[model samples]
Target: MSKGRGKMKKDTNIRIGTRGSALALWQANYISKSLSKLGVKSEIIIIKTLGDKLTRGVLSQNRNRGKSFFVKEIEDALLNYEIDIAVHSLKDVPPDMPDGLILAAVAKREDPSDAYISRKGNFLDHEKRKSIIGTSSPRRIAQLKHFYPEFSFMTLRGNVETRIRKMHELKLDGIVLAYAGVKRLGRKEEITKKIPISVILPAAGQGAIAVECRKKDRKVISILKELNDRRTSIAVEVERRVLTKLEGGCQVPVGVLARWRQDTLLVSAVIASLDGKEYLKEKSVMNQNNWKKKCDDLAELLLNRGGRAILKSIRK
Candidate 1:
């Protein structure tokens, strides 16, 4: 067969499943555009998940039920063959892959720093005792307590716009959100400050878009290879592996970020008590070639340095 004919034969229309949020649509449209450049046709299908439906109050009541909260319904659609692809905010995906699903690609990441948005300028530095900051992420809450325990935190939840609106309606002093989401949604101007990674490490795969497909779908996997970013894939993989070893998730107060610098991989990880009283942090730098083993070693180091006890107490 001619190469042109072969290419035509392989050009199957892909069905992409994603959440209905603005950020999720941005990611889905991004993949769709990237595929269009490669001469592939695709459709974006919105699927709502439990994460979207549950309020913060319900979530607090069911702390143990959110690792795959955002991606579960989308994955179900993919597994049932209703969709050929599933795009997700990599941070929302659990470290453990479902039996039949595989992470086919990791798109190039956006800025991984969390953004601090306040109507009042530069709130993190100012001496504002008892200010009500808005966030529900255990990781963010723990770090904020550890660093700026003077401020009070309220559980804030919704899509980006909703959260931002709530910050006004609830009279919140400020809110911390992923800068990637804010930039993607064209709300960069709303960010009063970009939180430094040194102050609060991002969750594993925080800024990257993850593509998932059935394990046996070789054609979808091949198509997705064009979307994969190597450095990002390695960095998220290393971070996720560390989180998996630690058995950390949305319910746990753990933060991890991995980056590639030339041929080296640098990972900074932290595990803290829910109240932020006790904490364990480790920064590991290792050769990128042996990243798997190095990531395991890094997790072990954190666990040995009081991480295990912190996790045990939190679970209990």
Candidate 2:
């Protein structure tokens, strides 16, 4: 029995853990294909997380429950040696990782913008008054309020397909979702409009898939490194550092978007109150070689300029 267990641990096969949602499976299969190209094999194990189980309440209401609501269970599986790696939607991951876990690689990013899916024509049409939009993200709600103060929003829960279904079933005027998820599921045709990042910055690490493993799993890390996109990883890291410095959680009404252009990395971020009555926006640019310093400076700039107070108000 001991020898059999040892063999299993030493096997070349890698087991990947992920949420069972359609978008998650798509990400897992993508990793699998990427590994296959390198002569490695992998199997995906679907795991249900606390976030997945809580299908009724708005995520903001459960913010106090703690961060890592979506990735906790999968990380547990990895710690117990049940899965060699875990795949997560980078935006859902908290900035601080568990003691034994590390984000090993980040896949290439897709469009990081949010999509507006509306049944009643363009959502931004000034003629559309008193429109009801569906979203569960405080970030989206606060930012949208800043742009279209007249629109009312309701808490939208469920997977992408379920949310779209509910949009029709509930007779909602429109819904907001990540462009990456819709594009991954091949539902791009349903997008009524792509909300520009200029008007609404994306969540930190949005549109990127992260692969995590135990810190001691050097072999798996080495195998996964080939899939990491350097530019995407750097961009996401800058955004995540801002969130970490701000001590923001996944549900906080904070939005950050970062990109690399020419020889510079530019980051735009916002921290807003739930009511959108108070907010702060900061844009920082620096040479790519000094990305870390730029991220720190940007975070500090926001914090000093009412961003700290906005965060405090949100917590209260």
Candidate 3:
């Protein structure tokens, strides 16, 4: 086919499934626009998951038996042929997935680092240091225990907006969040400080968007070949493989964030006990091209060294 004809042919119709939330919609639209640039026509279908239905709980508080907490409902639609593909915040997706579902693409990531939002100028106000900081993740809780043990934290469960509003209502000093989410929601002004990823190793796949499709959907995969971001995939995959190997669940505290600088990958890992008194933090720099293997090896080493001890301590 001629280049023009190929462009026209690439204008395949696609249905993108996503959660009916502001941040999800933003990510979906961003993908849709990027697809349009390559002549693909797309629409978004909103699907609700169990996590979305819950109003007052954290995922870690719930039990897991291999079912995905955030992506299962949407993946069901993909398998049923109700939707061609599903887009998600990678952090929300569990490390493991259901049968017949495959993570097809990961878009270029934004800042994977967390942020602190304080209404009173500086994100973490020493004056309000004794006040509460809102969050629902045990990983965050563990880190807080290790670093900012004095600050009080409560389960701030709900959508992004709801959590932010709750922080205002409680008149808490500040709330912690993923920097990427706030930027996607167009709430840059709400940011009080950009937390360093160096210290707060982010959740796996935190800043990227995930596209999942039925493993058999070759057409959808063919079309979405245009949407894959290789660098983002490499970085997220490296971290995710570690999670998979170590049996990381939302309930435990394990965080890893790896950054690519030219030819080198700087990886940082944090393993913390449930009580956060004892912690194992480590960092290593390796050739970026071999990051995937480096990360997997690091996860293995961590488990053998002190990660196993930390996990056992936390589960008890």
Q: Which TM-score value belongs to model 3?
A: 0.90
Instruction: Please give, for residues 105-150, the per-residue lDDT of candidate 3 as tens digits.
Output: 8999999988888757664535354767788777777787777777
- Where does candidate 1 stray beyond 4 Å? 1-12
Q: What lDDT tens digits, residue by residue, belong to model 1 across residues 49-103?
A: 9988886587666556676788889988877787889999999999887898999
Task: List model 2 lDDT by residue over 209-292, tens digit each.
Answer: 999988887888898899999889988988999888887876788899888887678889999888777778999987667878
RMSD of each: 4.1, 2.2, 4.9
State model 2's lDDT: 0.86
Per-prediction TM-score to the true structure, in the order listed: 0.95, 0.95, 0.90
> Which is the winner by TM-score between candidate 1 and candidate 3?
1
If both were scored by lDDT, which would come out higher, candidate 2 or candidate 3? 2
Candidate 2 clashing pairs, residues 3+ apart or interchain? none
Cα distance off (Å), candidate 1, residue 5 = 25
In model 2, the runs with Cα more than 4 Å from the true position are 1-10, 64-67
Candidates' C-alpha lDDT: 0.87, 0.86, 0.77
Cα displacement (angstroms), candidate 2, residue 162, comes to 0.6
